[model samples]
Target chain A: MANSNTQADFRTRLQDWIPKLVLSPSLAAMLVFVYGFIAFTVYLSFTGSKMLPKYDWIGFENYARLWGLSHWWTAITNLGIFAFLYITICTIIGLGLAIFLDQKIRGEGMLRPIYLYPMALSFIVTGTAWKWIMDPGIGIENTMHLWGWESFEFGWIKDRDMAIYTVVIAAVWQTSGFVMAMFLAGLRGIDNEILKAAQIDGASNWNLYRRIVIPLLRPAFLSAFVILSHLAVKSYDLIIALTGGGPGRATELPATFMYSYTFTRNSMGIGAASAVIMLMTIAAIMTPYLYAELKEKA
Target chain B: MSVATQDTAVSTGRVTRTFIYLLLILFALFYLMPLFVMVANSLKPLPEITGGNMMALPQDWTIEPWLQAWSSAQIGVEPTGLKPYFLNSVLMVVPAVAISTVLGALNGYVLTKWRFRGDSILFGLMLFSCFIPFQIVLIPMAMILGKLGLAGSIPGLVLVHVVYGVGFTTLYYRNYYAAFPTELVRAAMIDGAGFFRIFWRIMLPVSGPITVVSVIWQFTNIWNDFLFGASFGGQSQPMTVALNNLVQSSTGVKEYNVHFAGAILAALPTLLVYIVAGRYFVRGLMAGSVKG
Candidate 1:
């Protein structure tokens, strides 16, 4: 009787502790998988880790090698070019679309979905479709030539110098709809009486938008810019799908470089260094915005 | 301040209306052009699709590509079909989204209403995790997964995705709940409701829009994933990986029609969601951005 009672008491305690115990697996997962992996990457970058995880530490050598590599330099320059152009163009285009779409026009609902449909399609689909559409011999250029406009030059995707911009175009298509939706929401939230009052002062359309509407949409722009910048930095699958970071690495971004280094070349240490560098770069860009946002919310 | 003001207001409104309409029509076309091209390409034969006249209607329209895509191109097993891949993607995505959202909501609730001593530190850690790129940890993660004997399994992929997904979903829920009034929680507590009961009875009921949003976003993200599938999932891969192999093989004489059809097949779910629940998706996006 005493033994049975002790067993029952133990069972009761186990059942009571089950809920708290359940959290242990996930907590362990976060520690071992998430935190552990991050720390491992940092440590690996300091070691001469090749295809496999190495224990021997060769401190700062990988960083020095990464700094000296031409491919890394190209990637950095391409990232700068890609980020600058893509972010700037996407923000401008997105803001314009949003401002235009905010007019409470007819068929606004129908048009909104149509614009956002690109987000539905994978970048692979877009890349393949666009590649065919931009093919010099078989695409729009050829078709136009058949229609008598022989002088048209629409081969951007195939061109090394202009290939990255093709990605910019496709990305703009994918995200501008999202930006419009955000801006439209912001616009709708604005008090209608403010616009009416502005109109009463004989403010022209351009003038009112330039002064009143633009300033009011600053929050939306900031939000869109941050998201776009993030997309730009973390770009990989899209670049791979669209150009394979090629026409000889002209379209390479840090993400793709890291991927190639780790997976293809098996340079784990250099790859980790690249990842750390990219992470730092993204942190630098995002930290200020995050702080401002938190402060504003507070 | 009366008559002149009224006249000026009417004139400016008219001008603005005209300008808005013109810009809308133009921008709408710009957005729709690529999609139109893709649709038009999907309808044509390989020869015509690759031949010329990208902006023109196909000289002869056929459903051959679609048929082939559904059958041979997308079909999983040689004898069976694309149904397996579709089911596989569904299985992976549904569980992933569901688990992540539930965990995210719990995390949010715990952080917001039931603050512990180290709550801020935990929340900060979650936030920090979002900035940690996948590239940074891919090798180590792979190694860990290998050690756990889950290197190339659906559950393993789901597990990795969930770990990555939680950060974003937590952010979403935390922001959403923060924006919500706290009086409800207090009211529930006063009415003798415990934490879990209040969450289930009160918070979950009102969290419908966010739940839908989270599900939709998560579904798309997991469904369309490529890199993880390529690295971890391998031969037991999802549709996207298979689709990549299908396209990448054979350099000469591009199979444009089949490729287009494959693209369409791959995009069907997310596209369907966006088309059907587009308003909700937009609402979710706006909410997400504003909170950020």
Candidate 2:
């Protein structure tokens, strides 16, 4: 009876702690590694820490220094440029592809997969391929030269002024497919009768799509736009793989800058401050868009 | 079926059809062109890859690069290859996807069908968690993992993936469950089926489409990931990390062929998943549960 009771007590203890064991293991891992580090970094940002997490509580000094840093300002500016240009160009390309494919043409399925395959591939691959393709000495320009056209100058990638545009091109390739998928979903979900009625009214293809289709695809457009912008804001991998904020921080975005500061430079305070600012900027930028989108859906 | 209607349909639609086909073909070529260059170049020798036009087919076809990429050049060692890292990727991604999807489905079941207090709040928290950048939480998460002595282990990486994955998986499952009729759940409950029983007997069986979505999404992310694998996995890297070390940060003699082969190797799993699950992927998204 005593042994049975002891065994029962052990089982009860195991049962009682199982949830904690299971849930806390993962949660605690994330809370410490992810959330805990974030909090630690934020706290470190407020202190006079450098090289590592040392604390002296030098309130707002890190933020002020970060703001004063020209590279920091440049990174912020570059992020804005990237976010705007990338979002616009990708949206246009994606919408165009989606609309073109929505016509129920032959090979629609094949075309859809072709468009989306890049999204499946890593940004590293995309960046490598683009880098090689955009190389002035070896790629398209050289090909043109071998073909006896020596005047071709596709040197945007090497040029500091045009390097960001190359990144944009790669970005468009990687993301437009996702947007296309969203648009296609919206297109298929629309009522066929509306198109039939429009056709009966003698609407041309351009007019029908422009006036009827595009308007009805507002929900999809909104969703695609928000998602793309979010991605654009978080885009560090592509930038790193392609340029590494190359040609003297000319292509620097906030994420890479924060990474360099936090890890490479060992400037924990500034890094944390930059991270906080990035979070705030993203929140400020996205909250209104999300609200508008959700309101439309509601 | 009428002659006149057929003629009109043919005439009007033919122009549009031709235009659409032309555009699609062009876009398809544009999309395939770079991938084609990568693979075609990989087939060529290093000299040929560098010397010839990127568009050119390999004059001297060789499988040496593929062999090399599979063996020495893949992992840090110059002999063994990427077999271990590939196994690591599989080990982490499988459990990550399985756990996240199962938990997500459970959360969705409870939130959508069950009349529970604080359900909306829980759901909202899950949704909002998606927007929090990993950079914000990466440090703390890493520190915590280190504290727990799990910072450098595969199980630790799997746990991290599950935590991050929960938000996305929940969204996926919630979107799916919301589109489903509530009457089914109500009927099941009125029949005196307990929560776990209903989820197992009814919900799980019906969750085919969304399950595919969750599985594919989680698997792809976990597989293609570089940041999590690089940071959390440490010396024991996933395929992407090893691939990144090989291809991204290269040394003096750039073997373009090997790099291309490595890229192909790295992309194989996600590409295969996308191709296989492409139809259902679109179907799940078009199920129109996640409007935003």
Candidate 3:
């Protein structure tokens, strides 16, 4: 009996240690690959690591140069345009679709899947299909001309001034369905009693939504905004697939700037600098949102 | 049973309901047009596409473009088509998804059921891993890959994806396992089942739904990834990179049919998943949004 008891005690200790052993590998990998790399990126941003990484500290020279470059300015301005329009349009369209679908319209089960199919596709695929569709000579414009609308010029894709907007169109199409789904989930979570009480108070439909339901959707709205904001900043694949930065660098986003400089242009230090900036911006958005969520759960 | 339940809050007359249906139909058409156009044009000859009649059904259907895109499409100096890269993506996705999901199942089991000190912080650290942009890791990842001698290779790309993907897989499993009954684990322990034994015999059989969610999510994400594919994948790029090359490659003439075919081929797997397991996909999304 004593021998058996000792063996059981030994086995229990082994079981307790096994989970930590299983978990440590992933934890270590995340530490080294994710956080460690972030620190390395921040460090590289300050060094004169051009062409190849040289660790000699340069004291913000890369950032200074990054700021002074016209190309960088173009990328920042385009990011501004893309992020603002992408978020605003997706939010409005998503909200509208969610409300419309909430009315219990028929064929929703089918239509909802159709709306989400694009989200299933890679941005590369989205970019290509939209590129073909947006092609002026062979696409919408040409079709319009054949229908006797000869002057229906929808060549925003080729126009340097309007190419960024074309990106917005493709991105909105790619993601609005997902945003709609999020909003629909939010709408479903609304308490029916509050809605009934509002209805009983003789409130109009618009007034009921405006006063009670919409306000009640604050968490969903905030999550959507945070999600959309980060996605906008990380907008690389769509731009690459759709516009390839543009007719004349007209749609250059920070992500593209980072890639071109890092690998293509061989301006590694500057690329690292731009990457750090992108990280800071996203961190600024994600930190508080994640904190709130984790705190609530705790 | 009807999916549409009458809502007293937004109830309206027949005319308003008809208008809502019309609005929904128009939006659906708008959303599906690109897919319709791609399918239509991929079946047509070059003349029809260049002739600017895209919205019509293909008068002369052909599977040649798909074959061309799959076997003979030009990308950069090589004209090796998307087949090799498609294989590469498959190779990368299968291992990455499987490994990450398994690790996540274990990690989630430990974090949720076998609670330990500092588990939440560790979970937070792992969760934050998914948030950092891929670009932040490019400079160091290149160095790390070189040091490990896995740079610019399929294995290296898989490593990158798996390393990053563990966070999300862990998130899914942890959330699912959090809701799991720990009493079962306790009962299994009382029976003298070892840790791995309990996991294999007890936890895994019940983790089927979440495993589907994790697999689909990881498969779609790893397969669709371009940033990692473009950066770490060597001579044989992933399908997304190859598709990008096929589109951007200024080789011969711009073959719209081939481009359309390649785009559709790249999307086929995820599209298939969405078609087949859509409810699980939507449920996966709800699980994510509800928690984070």
Candidate 4:
């Protein structure tokens, strides 16, 4: 009896320990890899690391150099344009598509995939395909000429001033459908009786959508903005494949700038600084969004 | 009041409906243009392409570009095409997806059913990882990978993705498991089923929906990733990197058809996933945004 009691006590302890054991790997990994790396990057930003990691402390010099660079200025401005246009255009197209589909159209399954398929692809693939379509010699411009519209010219990929807009076009193409899906979900989730009530009240379609439908899609709109803004700030592969951040740095974003400085230009310190700035920018967008998310869960 | 006004309103409604269909078709066309161009151009030879005809069916049907993109296209000094990089992406994605999914399941089981103190704060921190730009961790991650002697390797890329991707995966599973009935778990425990036993037998058997969500989500993300693939995959770059290199290789002559083929080839897996399990794909995306 004594031996069996000791064995049962041991089993209870093991049961209690199992959850922690399963949970520890992920917790330790997050602490070390996520939080610990974040701290390490902050420290590196203050150091004079160049072409390699260095421990020599030189505080704020890298930040000063980073802010002073013209290329960094270009990246920041391009981000403003890209983020604004990407978020706004995707929202408009997505919202419009969602509303149109909400009208109970036929062949919805077929049409939904057509819009959603692009979001399934990698940006590199999107960029490469778009680059081909936007190529001056063999792309849309040439096709337009072949179609007898010789006045048409769509060479934004090769044009310095208009290159960023090309990035915007490709991004919107890839993600607007995703935004559409979100809005559609939100629209579907809405109570159908409200829409019916509006109809019975003799509200016109235009006023009905604007007053009730659009306002109720607020959560979808917020998600769309947050997701689009996040994608814009982190965009790198698309720029690399489409413009490589140029026709002379016209579409340079902080994400791309961080890469070139760290790996290509051999300036780790400034690269870290740029990364920190990008994090801060994302954090500004993310904190409240996260708060809302957690609060809702709570 | 009865006839003229009603006729006018009905005619206006018909016109508005026609306008709506036309607008939707036009938008769909715009959404599909690049993909159409890619497929159309990939099937045609260089001559048909350079003749300034993009939207037309191939006058000269050729699979040479597809073959070339798969086997002969140059990426850097190697003319060995995207095959190796495609394999590398598969290699990285499989392990990362499997590992992250399993870990997420464990984390979810613990966070919900086991519920120790401070688990929400721990999860909140993990949730924050999902929003962070990979740029912030690039430098330190590079160092850590080097210290572990996995830098620039496929495994290094896998480690990076798994560590970062676990956050999203955990969110998926946690939200899912939170809704799971605790009665079954308690019953299993009373029957002397241990943690792993209950998870493996009872919980996992019923996790089909969230598993689909988790696996498909991780697969697409790890497969489609470029920044980590570019930054860390080095000589063992993923398909996206190889595709970019193939498109921009700038050899003696530019091969537009080959670029189209390569791009389509690179996108095919995720495209197939969306096709086969599209409902689950949408569910995952919706769940990601709403729950996360």
What DockQ does candidate 3 have relative to the true complex? Answer: 0.69
lDDT for model 2 comes to 0.76
**lDDT of candidate model 3 versus the reference:** 0.88
Residue-wise C-alpha lDDT for candidate 4, range A1-298, written one tens digit per residue: 9999999999999999989999899989999988898898999999999999899999899999999999999999999999999999999999999888766566777788889889889999998888878887888888888889989999889888899999999999999998898898888777766766777788887887899888998887888888899999999999998889989889899999999999989999999999999999999998898888888886
Off by over 4 Å in 1: A1-28, A295-298, B1-22, B74-84, B284-292
lDDT of 3 by residue, B1-292 (tens): 1222344647678898888889888889989999999999988888889985878889999999989999998876787878888899998899999999999999999998888889999998887778888899988998899899998787898899899999999988888877777898899888878889988998898787788888998999999999988888877589999999999987678999999999999999999988899797667656542442
Each prediction's DockQ? Answer: 0.39, 0.35, 0.69, 0.52
| Candidate-wise lDDT, in order | 0.75, 0.76, 0.88, 0.87
lDDT of 2 at B77: 45
User: Would you give the TM-score of chain B in model 3?
Assistant: 0.94
Candidate 2 lDDT by residue in tens digits, A177-248: 788888877776677767777888888877888999899999787777778777877777788777878868
Worst 10 residues of 4 chain B by lDDT: B2-11
Clashes in model 4: which pairs?
Answer: none
Candidate achieving the largest DockQ = 3
- Candidate 1 falls in which docking quality class? acceptable
**CAPRI-style class, candidate 2:** acceptable
Q: Fnat of the models, one by one? A: 0.45, 0.40, 0.71, 0.76
Residue B221 CA displacement from its true place in model 2, Å:
0.9
TM-score of 4: 0.95
